[model samples]
Target: MLKLSEYTHNQAQVESHYLYKSLCKWAAKQPHATFIVEAETERKLSYAQALAAVHELRKAFGPAPRRLLLALPSGIANALVWLSALTGGHQLIPFPAGARNEEKARIAHRYTPELLLTEQPEEAEGFGLAQARVMTLAACEALIKQAASLEAMEPLPGQVWLTTSGTTGEPKGVVLNEQQISWTAEQVRLSHQLTPQDHGLTVLPFFHVNAPVVSLCSSLLAGSTVVIARRFSRSHFWSWIKRYQVTWASIVPTIVAMLLETEKPAFLPGKLRFMRTGAAALPIPDLLTFEVRFGIPVIETYGLSEAASQVVANPLPPSKRKPGSAGRPVGISLRICQPRTDETADLCDVRAGETGEICIAGPSLIRAYQHNASATAFQDGWFRTGDLGYVDKDGYLFIKGRLREVIIRGGENIAPREIEEVLLSHPLVREAAAVGRPDPIYGEQVVAYVVVKTRWSTQLAQELHQYAAQRLSQPKVPVDFIALDTLPKNPTGKLERRLLRAREQARFTAQDVASHTA
Candidate 1:
């Protein structure tokens, strides 16, 4: 995750504050605005009821651990508690409501919470429940049934904590204080000039700050209505856009591709003001197609969990909005820092047009992790963003790609060496380089370019898939396999994955082969 300092100086003045206080302030101002609505569900809340529920929650769980896990959908009740949890003096830890029952239990054990709020009581993982209370959506309503209950307390400054990708390597928890999150939201509101007339349709998981802080919080702060979808579905994307009159939304490249591949919705929603893509680079093709179809600007952005990053965004109004350039530093400054040999030495910034590691420091950025002392994101004051991008003479920042040597398959991370080592063990396989290729559903799926001495068979593909599936998660398994007669390498014999990927994809098309038959 990129640190906020690696980017700007405007961040130095960020004051200490808590998120709960922000909610209270917003609720005090506009208590009648609609906060959230779950798709297909009649259940929802106006800002007034949302404030009431949040106040009840604060009273129920007084000052305690600053971390709280919100295992609920992106509905009205969920949104209310989500704000309450963060503003109620806790970090909201959200997880995908997938089949991973044990993982939820594990998190409950790992981050002991003062409260574990969910819509399902029976779903609570076995451990960490004795002391931690279980309050479902129905129970939350019951609290109101008794009487108007409100909790009063000063907000816990520096209370926000969010998680980014950590499937295998040490899970790094990106910690940001309440003030940083609020400021970032405020900046977006000002920079974009968004107003209550806009209604945001947020489908990204709320656990991640991307959905909450970026899309939802920004909308609410502007008094704009927000329509929350529990999960993203390409089938219903445009329908929801039209249904809710969604003006703004943030999406990942993978979802954008899905929309492109699927039949264009009956009609593009006219109310969509803008769309932002982040969490990964927007594919060139997907970016162009989306705008052509929707007639809306497809803005791009750069952000990280730590440092409250939100480094840059597409330019607005009269300025020509570049399609690929993440645009100049929005609400922040970005510079590439060349690492020096000295351990304690400060890094130097590279000249514009020069390629180096992107370094950032800003008000939106955070200094450290929550209870995690092992994080090495900071150097001097700037945070090292493990991304390799360059700025043009126009001062526009364009990200080339990730500096992290991990394969992204379908928006999932898989260490390359892990797949390489596994494939090399096969008796017929000679060598391998696992790289990612663009896919409609998965953003990028793993493709292995291989050199083999023996004949390849479908059995081999199944065997490799099974091999990796047992040892690693499903996302790490290569969806596409390339078998080559010889290794195409440099004179020094280093395998050229870029060349191999081109060759492999070319052969598949040349052969006119349909997707590998089962």
Candidate 2:
């Protein structure tokens, strides 16, 4: 394995080159290299065909619009539009295709994009956008045929706008320019030791940074092929892996757990080097169990939409991979800092090994949120992440929990992850979430919600509580344990703790009213 200093220095070179231009250059040189394979249709596009398709799509655009709103599903068409929008010099905002109508309206009203692209043109009314400004998949396909063949055009600089997962409040729009996007992709390619022989499997939505920057763009930078799936189908996941001969895959922790729950395939397909999991905190037990059960190592990574998907990842093999850590900062600078609050912008003062806010700065990180400068304050180019963690002596990053997710009990600050991790170690607990519930006595008390593999029962809840009691201190143990078939998760499969707290509060209010009447 290369030394950390050597890796950082080598990756520094990739920032100078634009990813879109490099992709085009590589495509023209290696025209015959397989670039994309659509698993649903068993369709494939070689680099030559992909380049031609992108050119056709660009020509279809005619004049580059100021902003393009994309709500296309995962497939070859969506991939083409993404490349075309970036290369043709148009600001792009790709909304998750499965987003709710209200969510779509919120963005459309805010941005008022010049063009809205979707798989279903009839649904354009839902966004309250003019029909004339909307282009359906059919329209894009028709334009592709009418597009005139032309020489390779110079790549243009454009911005890609993305929204935070909105797990807490209204999602904030994050903006990244072409250079930032491409540089981040190159960083991922270099960090993962990607090669032309590699094949990436992407089931993540196009709206997420992981799909575009981590999987597709990184594969392009490495001169590798990517298999695009319409949606994540656990039943067909392993089969597709076998069919496509996939080398590695980009997935979230939820998908990883689901795949593990599914029965094992008779024979695992391809020479799957590793599976990269991120976008949410992965339970340490799940990470270790996956490696033990599937024999494919799970490379845990950490990043945000603002950083263009990956800022750090566990190096590909033969190197030390700390199971619980998010690995070292790759092609970026990281710092542990004193926690910042909403009222003030202060410099970080934490030392190494001291728990604090995880802060980062790099070419890949966006300096500002779109139209929301007040949301973030940068100190010495470092963006305070709001995530809490500390770097170990060996430099691996360990996440404690989100600062907002921290629970306070009788003025004692507690990270929910610490208790959640202990609860998840129970064999019956498939998923667990710990949050603070309003309490008159303690200001706030710990409460837990869990999803069990077996049937829900009072006996089971008691067993889980007793198990947690054995592992956790008196105040750390949950005051209540609620068993559910499944916990509430957002579109990205992250547990919604805020919503859980709200629901629990409402339920308690209702209980109080009933008791007063009785």
Candidate 3:
């Protein structure tokens, strides 16, 4: 029978002892095991080679811990640094090689590390920034000829910091501790069923907790080979999967939708055993289409950076995979909280019928936002998820939508996801976005921006509006629809609603003036 896995962890394992030092624990038993297969060049690293490389660097780092920002290709060297950072006992900030100069500078300054680890180990010429002792992967390689016995250095192991996309504000660091990392990895391993036999593929950026902790750490701890993508490319996805024989991978909804289209998939490696998707709500229609084509399950899950990356993942058994739901809570307990004048209270069994804010509490949940003191807390020390959903009688959790996303019109509330989903059903629509524009009389107006498919024409827009009107209620039908070749998208490929809103407001203002003059 399935039950919540214990999250109990000993800090000594992931934190107190250096990262690479304990990596030796996992490696000693399987020194010859292959741990990495570089995605770009197909170079493989056995456990012994990986361990030896890290040991060489550990000796060079010397007594005092160095703040090493990991910068290398997504291959053996990259994998070695990651293990070395943890086991070798350095405070690690894994930097993405492809990050923009501005983003790189911003993050580097924020971490304030003493040393920068990169493939090109040199003092950068024009950074105009604080100088960190630059050490390249090449420099570390040269030191191998004159290595001395190096003891692992344990770090001041708290607070592994992560940053948000900063779409809202200058990204505040999301701090995590060693217990959080080790505990979260263990929970995710059991939740995702990651094991040595599982061939994992990672396209998510290592900078994010979802990829680093959930995908990378979870897989490695289970002794699985993770195929790391230097960067995520829709065109390269199928080829990488086929080449790596990836059994499991994680993706957001955008990539899944692209893969679901009726073109011949570039199935370079063939199909994965299953896909785990999260970070945003996935549309159900595309979800169904993807499952049918791939012949593998798309396991929708719920997670947050605050909660160590994963909370609820759909279990693997065919019977357990629900087409629309994000599946059940995995390695954690979920509850719906009844909103009160003062605070929200947990409704764990929630009668299996009503909607409420989906709140989760478990060892994986963050103690609190790194330094955000003004935060909402519900009963049992659970963070208010700001999301509304309910579990059905069958225990399948269905996310209605985010609380902030619900729109109000004529004193009635409407979910934009529902409207967007309906609009997306129109064959002429290639992509759709719904936003509430400020209105004088109605308080808020529902507006949609659409991208038409190549085969479709301007006439299809009218047909789509009519199509939505017939199926959806009056308030739900968009009052104004604008056609675009494409919508602004975020780095992760999710539609940038905040940008779309600015555009919508501009159009609305222009229309109002034109109407007044006419």
Best by lDDT: 2
Give the candidate number with the greatest TM-score.
Answer: 1
**What would the TM-scores of all predictions be?**
0.78, 0.76, 0.68
lDDT of 1 by residue, 1-518 (tens): 22324444233343455345445566677766676777656355666566667677767766655556667666665666666666656666665443244445556766776566676776565434677767776776665444343344565543655545432233466766667787777666765667868877777766667777777677767777778887888778888888777788878787787777777666776677788777777877778888887677888877767645466777664677787888767666567776444446577777657777777766677776656654565776677776778877776678887655455554444567667777887777888888766554565677777777667888877776776665444666787786777767898986665675566457556554556442
The stretch of ten residues in a row with the least summed lDDT in candidate 3 is: 1-10
Candidate 2 vs 3: which has more lDDT: 2
TM-score for candidate 2, please give it. 0.76
- Candidate ranking (lDDT, best to worst): 2, 1, 3
Candidate 3 C-alpha error for residue 365, in Å = 2.6
Model 1 stretches astray by more than 4 angstroms: 1-22, 99-102, 105-109, 126-131, 141-153, 165-169, 262-269, 339-346, 370-375, 407-441, 446-518
